[model samples]
Target: MCYNATTSATAFTISVLCSIYLIYSGNKTHNNVDIFAGIATFMIGLMQLLEYVLWKNQDCNWINKYASMSIPVVLYLQIIVFHIANKYLYNATSPTYDNVYIIMNILFAIYVICLLVWLSDQKLCSKPSANSCRLVWAPFEKLLNYKYGSYNVGWVLLLLGFLFYIQFGIPLNGLFYLQRSFSVHKHNYPIRNIFPYITIIAALVYTIVTDGKRMSDTFGSMWCFLCVSYGIVSIMHI
Candidate 1:
């Protein structure tokens, strides 16, 4: 099955509870990163629940398509926001921080527009079928489409954002702050430093695997699982 009801239900429940707790406590803490992370987590759980429901109905194209693609944008936002929040926690504000946040927001907006256009142009079907179902193309073909060059622009922005995130957010801010927050023996600083790189590597490997077989359900599931699991872990650290 494309979406297992049992598993999705369980995920949905846990995600909802997490969302409530994170939002409530995040407000108390006055942390934007945790707030956004909580929002992203809530969305993830909502998306999983929607996927489960839509899988049975099969006629809800717009909602399903948009929900699926919009996830990455929020996921990226959560990470960037986390970086800013972490900096606030440490009182390590930089002059360029606002500029970085603005740039990232612009890029995120561009990506969202591009993805929405791509999804809206899709050839949707009421029922899932080999010829009608476009699951594989959703991530590969649709996302990569260069019509109007928005896709290219989106990718450029995303790549630049990734570099900035790693440069300012992950290696310097994230690693240092996390190390300070947790004891040396309790937290593996080196591993934490490498986590972002690991995620990038995993994305590259998944892209290669998907390129070989776009329609492979197993590969897609594995990719989604890794990404979602990693996202959850990242949020927990916030």
Candidate 2:
């Protein structure tokens, strides 16, 4: 008998759709973290959808238990972490270039490390329990090398994107209608012609080189989607 979890399905569908719509609209407009951040958001939603639907249909209790209980929560938390990271980069008004981004990323790394330790220490929740599904993080991180080296490099690029958006994009495009008296053309933005493009391309190329084929394929797809969408849209509006 097929499980009748329409509520879960509906929730996932709504989230994914909202994410897609936001990305599309945000891309066509200008640099919006709503679009950049939507990648992780939609991935979380997709995982949730798979947990509910795939788990039930496959008749795999373990898969359901693991995915529904642990995976979605972990994915959700990661998405939130990235969201905060992006926001921090966006609102950065500091004069020191790269310092703020480096500091922001350092804090983020510390947070993730602490979170992993706390979760694994078994004080927060029982391992493999309904709420104890965060165990996937430890081994996964090790195997995927999602820390220090490659991951650190990736964080730097993301930080660049956020800072670029805040300083250049917000001023030129006017997100919250903070219009300036000094008129400047859309294409006149400093990083518009170079930094963003180079940053994204370099990130994907590095990931492909260092992280092997799997990560290359994975983040490469995301890189292509984001960079291409932003390029096309930004160019069109220019």
Candidate 3:
């Protein structure tokens, strides 16, 4: 296993708790964003638990399948969280609804469709092997001990998501517009930007560092530590 079962299990438990709270809060406030965040958190928690179980069973092939499937979900959810947070923070109501957001949703859906098609083409999802899905990005390809991997398109999606996030927070005129618009909203801009970025960065760093080295256990331990810390902060926020 790339990570410890106990650590993953603990993180999973924390995630489940955080998700429950988010769902309750979302329902109470009628906030769709909070509900999405709750769902994302639950998915991540479930993935971690599933990974733990597969690891316990010594099923590397299934681990590969799970990671391949889950990473995109995580990345997409990160985008959603950031975009929603950006909308709330800036209060930038576009003249008509947010066409950009709609476009992004459509694009993301298309991208997922393409990804599934690619997965089918490679037969990675149907096949069973430890490294069959290994067609990833430049560094991640190396990190996962494969020359290539199945998530080449995922890297593109993640980049697009991040770009959209920055754009949402600071539109074409950029941070200057953001500052000017804040005057109208009057709500203190809580550092809501930090969470999604931190989560993405931590997940990326953990993936790269843990998989790129022979002594992955050491890095995996730190990854678990970071996940725990993030979970604690998330609960406090909820």
Candidate 4:
């Protein structure tokens, strides 16, 4: 997802280091949440490594196809795992919240299915910047242009769906924390308590700004980088 292989590799290395730290700290403090977060971070790093391979290959070969496919699948698995860990940590047993969670997962499943279908017809091509390659489907771009006047709409919608899919858990977790905070008589808001909301807000702002200013082709790569980097940094607050 990075602009180049070096950037992707660097991100992977940083993620690995952060993952190790999180796991070690979790074990020392006996916090299973941190341990789960560490696993998620490691998965993000693995995705970055796959991205690095894609960047290096930049071809229509099986290696590029599988690497590109793995990124989304890994991301989907990581988010599901993280959601389960968070629910377990919070003991989220409310029927209403559980129903909402199920609905969100169903929507995310649909998005992933569409995304995989879209990717199946895409081919790797160099970006206008020539600094990196991206997956492009000429027919999709033409269809968007014909229907909407702008080719960016499809990418924007896809990105929005992805954002909603990954971030839906944040508010659910936040609601639980807010209720617990009110009942616990806590005077100060700890970083751990507000980190999820902060992450959601930050992600929204970053994606909006980047998409507005950059080419549509960069949206997926840039967002993947941001999410993984945020995942690494957010471990400290856990």
Candidate 5:
């Protein structure tokens, strides 16, 4: 579980750094793009790490699986946006976006490969524990064809995540301003009220919609769990 272990440790580290910056930035780095990426980077990084290592051992380390597959899409999008909009936010290179993109892309590719191996085998849920890394080539003589359908129960879940992602940051700006506000007689520091119910819903939909043996199944399901769980955990800690 090197990936899993690394991801968890990395998430904690990034979260700590972001937390410090948020708490003690003293209005200095308030508009930093790197700062904005603090939570996004940590959440995806840690989640992917878990997915890579855990999947090597178990067919489904349900939580890690979601993180590994789904969060990259966000990371990819965030990096692109932050790089383009650095000044409005901050300088371009605070959080090592280059390394994040390169490393995440590689990790994403590996996890996909692992999923391919799993899909080729029929005995997905039932198996003995040790050293079960299957080959890239299919175990069965006939190759299994995987499909991603537009119409399904899974659409409901995707919709839920879409909504949460859009709404979660409404009061987040004020969260960074909390310390200064605390000294005042009355204050309304920004706050975000969010519950990641969509993440779970998405996972269920992915499960119902996709073929269990396909790599898409592994990634799609895991993505939902990681996104929501990471958000919930981060907010609670905050």
Candidate 6:
């Protein structure tokens, strides 16, 4: 998750290779679901590539504005891909869960729209390090502190908790239920069953290990990187 042009380019390359392999294997095996997963993988790679562009052209205002705008859309598309894949792979057609997905997408849409609107007046990009032009929510920091009070640890924790729950918790919860309901042999589905927990743990580790100052500078970028990078794990399902 290092925010540098080199690392971003490398991630994009790896994701591209992995996506090609996954798609080719899916085609040969006639597994349409795998194709969807491959597409998701490619989306993740696309995001990293966008980051690379932003890193390289940090001084270009138009490039930064459009590229920054594209990031949230790409991130949201990943969730849509997951929803489609879940339906095809697990036959997850439960109306309740479908409604949950719909609501989640709506909420995510509002969140993205609000963020983009809020950052419209300010530069949506940040140069956290000499070589890094990372997307961040720095513009919101002042507003958040002003609204919630400065040095409000509780508010930060609550905000992060909600973000994580929306980004990971709900989808994983739905997946967990779907897997259990669909699997023919429950005992054999260890990896799928525990994957959500693993993801949550990894995210927690990320939050704990990232430098606080760096986290403030690149909180949005860090979370997006974590989500996209971990998306490679979809290969396991494929």
Tell me the spans in candidate 4 whose CA falls farther than 4 Å from its real position.
124-156, 169-211, 215-238
The TM-score, computed over Cα atoms with residue i paired to residue i, of candidate 6 is 0.69
Lowest lDDT 10-residue stretch of candidate 5: 134-143
Model 5 bad stretches (over 4 Å): 1-14, 19-57, 61-65, 80-87, 90-238
- Better by TM-score, candidate 6 or 4: 6
- The CA lDDT at 234 in model 5 is 44
Candidate 2: tens digits of C-alpha lDDT, residues 1-238? 0122454455466556656765687678654544543454455355345434443543434454344335324433443444343444245233453465455555545544554453343322112212222122222323233356445444454344345433423222223211221122232333433334455556557666775434323332343243233334333333
Compared with the true structure, all predictions reach lDDT values of: 0.50, 0.40, 0.48, 0.58, 0.37, 0.58
Worst 10 residues of 4 by lDDT: 135-144
| Tens digit per residue, CA lDDT, model 6, 1-238 | 3467887788788777777876888778766545644665676577677777777777747777667667656666666666666566556566876786678778777776775676566555534443245545333443344344445654464375357344533343345544644463222334534554565556656667774444443444544454355445656662
Query: For candidate 1, lDDT tens digit of each residue in 33-84?
Result: 4454455456545545544554554555665565555545544555565665
Off by over 4 Å in 3: 22-40, 43-46, 53-67, 77-97, 123-193, 198-227
Candidate 6 lDDT score at position 164: 37
RMSD in order of candidates: 6.5, 16.2, 7.6, 5.1, 16.5, 4.8
TM-score for each predicted model, relative to the true structure: 0.54, 0.33, 0.51, 0.67, 0.28, 0.69
Per-residue lDDT over 42-158 for candidate 3, one digit per residue giving the tens place of the 0 to 100 score: 654654665465445443364555555554455455556545654654555664446756776677757655654544334222121234221222122222332245554544554
- Cα deviation in Å at residue 237, candidate 1? 9.0
Q: Best by TM-score, which number?
A: 6
Instruction: Report lDDT (Cα) of residue 214, candidate 4.
Output: 32
| Residue 129 lDDT, candidate 2, scale 0-100 | 18
Residue pairs with backbone overlap in model 4: none
lDDT computed for candidate 4: 0.58
- Which residue pairs show backbone clashes in model 1? none
Model 3 lDDT, full chain set? 0.48
